[model samples]
Target chain A: MTSAPALVPRPLARARPLVEPALREAVDRLHPWLARIVGYSFGWCAADGSPSATPGGKGIRCALALLAAEAAGGAARDAVPAAVAVELVHGFSLVHDDIMDGDELRRSRPTVWKAYGTGPAVLAGDAMLTVAMATAARTGSRAALGELVGALDWLVRGQAEDLAFESRAFTGPDAVTVEEYLAMASGKTGALLGCAAAMGAALAGARGEAVTAYRDFGRHLGVAFQAIDDVLSVFGDPHRTGKPAGGDLTSGKKTLPVLEALAASTPASSRLARLLLERPLAEGQLTEAALLIDRAGGRRRTEAWAHIHHQRALHALHSAAPLPCPKADLTEVAAHLLHRTA
Target chain B: MTSAPALVPRPLARARPLVEPALREAVDRLHPWLARIVGYSFGWCAADGSPSATPGGKGIRCALALLAAEAAGGAARDAVPAAVAVELVHGFSLVHDDIMDGDELRRSRPTVWKAYGTGPAVLAGDAMLTVAMATAARTGSRAALGELVGALDWLVRGQAEDLAFESRAFTGPDAVTVEEYLAMASGKTGALLGCAAAMGAALAGARGEAVTAYRDFGRHLGVAFQAIDDVLSVFGDPHRTGKPAGGDLTSGKKTLPVLEALAASTPASSRLARLLLERPLAEGQLTEAALLIDRAGGRRRTEAWAHIHHQRALHALHSAAPLPCPKADLTEVAAHLLHRTA
Candidate 1:
């Protein structure tokens, strides 16, 4: 759990050149050729229910997976299936989570349920989950299946807890802190990413401590990614992030920035908290809440936290560097993830 | 597939006499000892969440699972885990299906969603599903896992189709026939049972034709059981069935009896269909609809169909009987299932 150094050699930075093409090819190959309904919903095709050439997301999970495998001294080909599976599951979770959270926007477009309706979205997510398990099963290794299932279990458990939290009214503004929020995020977001990395390593035949190191690296990196995301939710540029600033604030989400602001706020900031939580925020209130978090130094605090975890992730990668694998690719992948803006 | 004959002794039925007690004991042992807030919505526990001696239903799925193993010439001990897994998955499906179908009463008691909230009910069902998969995984062998996953895939697919059928405003009064309904039922119910038998056989080293026979027996029996239940839904005495007369009619559910009635009915049956489909049926309309189905000979036809499946199942049992297992217990189980009043 120790943090990595703030600076390291950039030998793996060249991974950026290969990451996108490799990821797109892997995902395209894994895409279901038969079920058009599912294939369309996956955003590989157009919303008009026709096949299209649009690629989805940044493919961060797949990158991490491939890198982890290579870091474990295995070929990227060996890890491609696991990488694809992770991406599918991650997308599935996002689609379903959007439905549950009532968010209408994803990838700067209408959410799955918004476009296809709730039932289809649910079914699509279920299909994705099934495909993920099916993919793992087809890989035919008990240990690999075990890793996948374990990751999924944690992911679902985290989601269940988050949903439970959202459904209830929190009594006080500062009922939970940034640390507690991190725990939730660890499960909700970090676990899957960690699993993606660990599973890649596992598929590559990395056993014992190397597997643990890869998993820990992903876990720490996931936390950092989420922490950065929380910061972006409040302070990032809308054009770059593809989301309106203070979107989470308007939705009354108790993300790290909001939680940190609540803890650090004075009585004046209480007014902002009340405005955010008393009811749905108006457009003007969203701006006010974002400003309040800024004034309270919540944005800076979250950024600092993200940086710490990012460093720790890289450090874990370094520790795992000596485990007899090609360390360059994984090291580059970890750095790219830490530095990602979206 | 041709239906099997009626007089051949089923191995599941014959083995049941010896395995029933042991199966019950195994279930008892497997039941969580914590006395926690489990099985509350299942109505197998009281408000305080304490286990009730007479809480669970007839446990038909459990019996079939054990019988399948025994019929496959596997010892009950080896098959008990598979049996338990099948039953758990069955229960999980029931809980979720009730929620999706908006069913309030199951087995004459409030459904999980009605007893608890939707969240708890969903969670409970999910927990059961997780347990089922985990149990299957623990049972070991690639074949067992494959069978379990295949059954699960069919089960979920059947449910997705059922939900799709129900979500539409007009599911066509006679759009689907008895055969289609039976196919749905087979996927929704029979697949797991077949898997149970197959898994048991696999565990027992019942290879090739013996395994196929056991699976066939279980599948036919499952279809027969459902057909009988459908008949009971319409024509059987409410008190004996432990459900309201014409419950399916009231729900506008496309059961075999109603489908058969609609298919055979002339202009006279149109009124019944309208009554069932226009809106939720009133108590008076329910009675009128039931009488109309009787007048249309739907009741007799459905009963005859059930009898045919029952005979088929019996024949399948006979075909599976040469696998070197006790005949008495399997025969008893088959009789108990085919002849059950509720």
Candidate 2:
């Protein structure tokens, strides 16, 4: 066993049809070629524009939005546009990130950039983003539009910072501090998820404080989710890749664990760094690197951080809506994220 | 002189201060790091972020917006936000285009991509686009938001097509048709300019027909502007770089001349294709390529097309607002573009 169960809460999984039609509609809004490329990127179509049955990400963001609206005592259906807008933005970012990160495959298929070539991928990403704005506008909420724009700005900033972390520091160190990594992660992932949750609350006509609470909850949840995912990439069950592990360690990503081990000020810290610095990480090296990270307390500390964020998210959600309890379902979501058995 | 005067018209020049402040404010809205890069892209800052006296491109898009407002019988001042939004979007596209094209210099200074690196440049472009949307939203018109989004969609589509033309088929045997080139030009340069002009009219509460007329006028003007710029780059006086006129020929851009020459059924067309097929055009080959292109009627036909669009723009403008005449100032603007001489 490597990590947590791959499960979304029942209600979140069931909420798909409520959000997906609108996603398809947003894709349809584009011109034919643009629509075809974007639809393929979203796993809605195969390489030749045929309908695809590929299961996409659990769409946790959409579920968060609908749940937020439901928790606010509003009809979740009314927030469909907001949900669709969130998905479009997410898709846009994924397409661009796949290109920028040189990711060749996604969701068991070739990435948009891999299949359509870089130029078309770029154009498709831009189109998705444009449609996202138009879709958001169609919701007829200027304030929500402003909120999403602000989140997107943070997203870009975070991406810039993330790329910068790849470079050596001006003082000659290439190591990323834990603090800097957290800030970057918050911007890159937390900001957009927080925006999604807040958008849902806003659509439900929740007051400012309630919306902010949802935003904060989503922000914490986003961090928690990323932390668990990073842990899984290092030690989780080999996601059907048929290999024991070839994830973050081989790529030299400075995830939470790596950063923690680097900051340990111990012999294992140097050992972990040495392993990480090797390209074409030798056979058995990824497993070795994981062991070193564990020895340096990187794995446990990261899990504890995830637990802390999960708790914070729950607390914030409680403040967002006290009357109706989503404690059980939301807990289920968190459990799926954190209960790893690696 | 082979073309129009090398000048900005009086009206366009006078509209500078009215538009400049808004541009500065838009820059100020960015995070400090982002602001510095974007401002440098706009030639408002030196490499070290200090203010620079470097002159930027003539604010033709801004002037069009103001002029469109004035033509629609509205005070130009009332359209400041619209103008600012246009400039922001324009800057966003320029930054991205520079990165994609690997352009190292603009306005006699290093491009953002060249100065700040690709990742930062991409982030700045994204930030500028977000700001453009927010700035457009400040105009308080959902209709204009829709208009801008529509134009942005076209912009992406055109860019995709333009990039596609760089392939062998489009530039070689399959040879991009004149119509295809026109459509690409319309999207690449015309859509945003047309959007800017129509945005100005729409901001002024112009009727639907009036706004549409302004949009058509701007689209025609954008195409005409691109056509003349293509011609100038091939034959007009060389820029301050002191390089002889080998700009487009050496790059093998599928410009009006190249496309026209390719479409021609003659020995010279074959000769032009052979020359273009060279891996790196020889030092003396660019001049020969230019002559072959001209002999194939590329230059004359392209100029005629520009003139036709120019007439259409004037016709559309006249239809947009008949009550108040902007005949002289608008003519000067047109002349400056169409009659450019070095």
Candidate 3:
């Protein structure tokens, strides 16, 4: 048997532009009828429900799934359903999350609940969840189906934990610490990504060792992705990010930066904690909170933390056995995710 | 190869008192740990969370599940998990339903949300749902797990439909027809009961025709049970039923009686339709609605419908292939469910 190849760096100029087209093509090939509904909900269509042909995100999850499969010497086509399933599940989670978070906009457009009523929006989310599970059960291997189900269980558990956290009277500074955040995100974000990669590996009929390696690679990449997201939530350009500056802080969402800031603050941190506890922050208070976060060196710390995870992700990919051409594409995808502005 | 036993005409008096103890013992046996949490939330326990030993209602779902398994020749011990699972799911649905319906009391005690905050109550319901699924997965066979999952899917679908119905601006008098109501209740109620029976049969290792027979018996019993519940909701004693008289009519729940009444009435049905449309009736409107239902002979017609389904359940039990002691116990269980007042 051929050993996996060492991770090779592709020339960034040539590799970067190909990702979007490939993702668009992959999504285009999903079941045409179901795609109509899913595509519309994902904002690939207009209010009148006309197809817009505008592609969504870079398809990071699908790329990881296919890459892991191909790295295991499986055909990428065999992993398509798993890829679609992951994306659909992701979309389903986003729809519900938006409602729970009371966010009015996503991807610079009105959210499902904002555009449609909550009732229909909820139904749409449920439909997506059902369709994802159905696709997995129908097209995926029994083992892959089992893995996907476990991943979903993790996702639900993560959501429950996050919601529970939000409702608490006071969460300790350590409660939202980096390690705890990572654990929560592991279930919230990493589980599905790892499942995607592992599922793809399973589809390729990969043996034990290679599948484990691919899953590890995917998990590291998922952490790296979320770390980058936390950074963007605080520091990215509002125009590029398509979100207001310091949206996470304003919303009282405890992202990596805020958590780090609270952990590292001097005696002054207690005052900040008191302010947050007193009542919902005013607009001016949000700006001050951002300033405190910056003064506490949170931005630098979070960035350094993100960079470490990024390096770890690359290390994981390198350690895995050499993948074929399609599998190698995943490394490029990982880089894109880590560096993505929006 | 022995056929399932025929139902003997045992005296109702002999079996009536044994029903409560057997149900209590079974519930006590099934959920040793989780049941305490559920029991407290379900008002089977006091506010301090101690078991009140206050008697529960009919335990219809558990009895049906156990009976189905037995009639299919499964060991009762092996089927206990399925029985517990169905009961928990039913209880979970009822807790959420009561919240949605704004009902203040259940079993002559405060509802979960009335006692606990909505947030905790929602979590309690979710926890129960989680426990039910986990129990099914852990305790049942692969086929039984699949059946349970399918039943859950149906339950969610039924809830979606029910929620959808509540928000409708106009369900044509034609829209609230008997067939539609049956379909709704089948998903809302019958699916879990069918799953319970099917799971029990699966655990018993019943296959082919016996499994189908048990499933049909459970489904018919569920319909009969719901029909009786509808009758109770409108016409039963408030003290014993633990609900207001004309509860379904007042809530505009569109039960079988209301549907039958609306469908069978002459042009005067429009007057009753208007009463329904003007829901949350004023001071004397509840009494007037009850009189209107009586004028339309809805009570008697709905009773006849319940009797028909009750007979169908018995017919199904009789036609099932013979088992030994368990099957006889199931027949007694069926009779007790059909004739139960509270």
Candidate 4:
């Protein structure tokens, strides 16, 4: 069942003032050029180092961290470093992801690799990764660095598989399976989100079952988030997505719905598979392909599939949420992620 | 004053059997293909995943880490995690360095990026970096991770400036000065080495002053090591170097000798200056550049410069060598680094 919407405080908005300022302060200490690159990546500065008020990511992951802390019966203020660390790590992955996937735009702006040359972009990502661990260290927990770095391995593994899947999706007879897609999504999206929540809870001194449940909640939410993202990538309103229509279909990324549609035995699936194998989908082919995907029930299947994960996430969130902890806002956060346009 | 050579035990040889296997065990836990890339990068496997012993480095850094543990009166076994962590970090840097510099050969074999495509290599390096931090966390010390992650920031900053220097050296009139070169070297080479020693000592329960002294010893040794490496890059016998002659010069790397010669005003230095700005070295220009570097006293000056750092390392080692701890093997490791031909 859908959880009740947040009636009072907005969790992410509350976390932003603390999270954003701390993130800016942390990266500000990087080397001059690195600081400039970070400033650009985070929407604080333009390419020429001038101020730019480009709104960055909604800090959803950052909010997950702080909310996890508050939901474990701790003050949100106590988890500021944890919030900073996860956001930095998320930015690190985004910077490197753009380079690896050869994507040109992120959040309606040029990717770091596109705006800067590959060398600078890659190194800048590396600096961010290093800074993430360093920032986490200030949390004074033996487990904070371990949890974040451990999540990174899963994240990288997921990315590696994602890259490998692109070449195999249409050609290889033994293409990646739906189960493999779920595993990859779990690692790529869910692992870091899980770490973000766990780090926040651990730093708040919420040990044992509370930590595990929070981590599970984040992971399932992440997979559900990935499924929703896949659905939107194909059918989203560009005005809301801040991206051109059919970006993922054009990029040939092996998102879950596409894989599911490809695996179907329907005639529309046959057309979609043929179109995928034909390489560059011709001009109007994208619109036709989207219709074919819908006809093959890919969109419905992915959306329905997401609800399973959403239910699991809610289950985990409720199971371990102590009565004293503030979870109303967390439930609202989850609902927003599920209902967001972009 | 040169410390007497090891008459008691071989430092690196004794440390290798301990370091190598632990490294293997560490990466063995990474994702499937990621493990294979790591195996190839570490020279434990060929491109096809078949076993191959192409000979990794001398494990000099690894030995330094383990020896630091012994020097702090801890069992060598107690520092295996630290040793593995440092070596993994070193390999992580090497993998990324090859990609960044587009070098094909490492230890006389194909670089990771060359053998595996850039995408897999980059992700593999990311995996290695993740594992390095995770393995360090097993030491049960929050300080271990903090120290290691801090050193990584310095290392990345050093590499960034080193790349920046390459462009400035040939394009701008204000080429990198000796002090700037030294600072970069300290960050690039000294920082990780310093971290290694500090991690080992800290793991062994060595507190405050002892750890600082150990860190200083490693940093000084790293600079000296860098200087000697510059000398060998230009002048060492190819058979010993395991690299084609003048590779660094042809690659236009701003090594110490080249930087020193560029700053000199002698006829040979003047000729060298013109040669460097003329773009990529022409046929036989590498040989000529080598001679010009020598004529400008770059070889002598760099060697003498190394000796000063060498003295500082020895002084630090002696001052910090506790009575209960072993020193003979540590002294040998020092002499070996200072005097090795390759």
Clashes of each: 16, 7, 8, 0
Query: What lDDT tens digits, residue by residue, belong to model 3 across residues B27-88?
Result: 34322333444576555687666768665545655656655666676555667777766767
Flag the better candidate by TM-score, 3 or 4: 4
Q: Order the numbered candidates by lDDT, best leading.
A: 4, 2, 1, 3
Interface quality of candidate 2 as DockQ: 0.46
Per residue, candidate 1 scores C-alpha lDDT tens digits across A140-249 of: 86766776776765676666666555644433753765676788778788888888788888888887677777778888888888887887787777766766666777
Q: TM-scores, in order shown?
A: 0.82, 0.89, 0.79, 0.95
Q: Write the per-residue lDDT of candidate 1 for residues B1-342, one digit (tens) a residue.
A: 233344424543344444445434433432232112235543457645666654455555556666566666666677767766776677767866776677777766777767765545554555555556656666666776777777777676666656555543322653766676777777777777777777777676666676677666667767777777887787677766656777777777777777777788566477766776665788887778878877877777776766676677667667765444444555566566666666
Comparing candidate 2 with candidate 3, which one achieves the higher TM-score? 2
Model 3: CAPRI class = incorrect
lDDT of 4 by residue, B65-113 (tens): 8888888988787778888988998889988877778788877888888
Candidate 2's residue-wise lDDT over A174-236, tens digit each? 567777877877778888888887887788787889988988888888888778767777876
Compare the candidates by lDDT and give the number of the best one: 4
By DockQ: ranked, best first: 4, 2, 1, 3
Worst 10 residues of 3 chain B by lDDT: B1-10
Give the winner by DockQ: 4
lDDT of 2 at B212: 91
User: What residue runs in model 3 are displaced by over 4 Å at the alpha carbon?
Assistant: A1-41, A44-58, A109-135, A138-142, A167-175, A207-213, A237-245, A266-279, A311-322, B1-59, B84-88, B95-140, B167-174, B242-247, B266-270, B322-324
Model 2 C-alpha lDDT per residue in residues B1-342, reported as the tens digit of each score: 244465567888888789898889878867677888888888888978999888776788888888888877787887788788888888888887776656666666778878987657766877788888878876768767777887887888788777777674535447778998899989988998889888888987888899898889889998998998788778766774322466667766779977787677668778888888784588688888888888888888888888999999989888886345555666678768777654
Q: Give the TM-score comparing model 2 with the true structure, all chains together.
A: 0.89
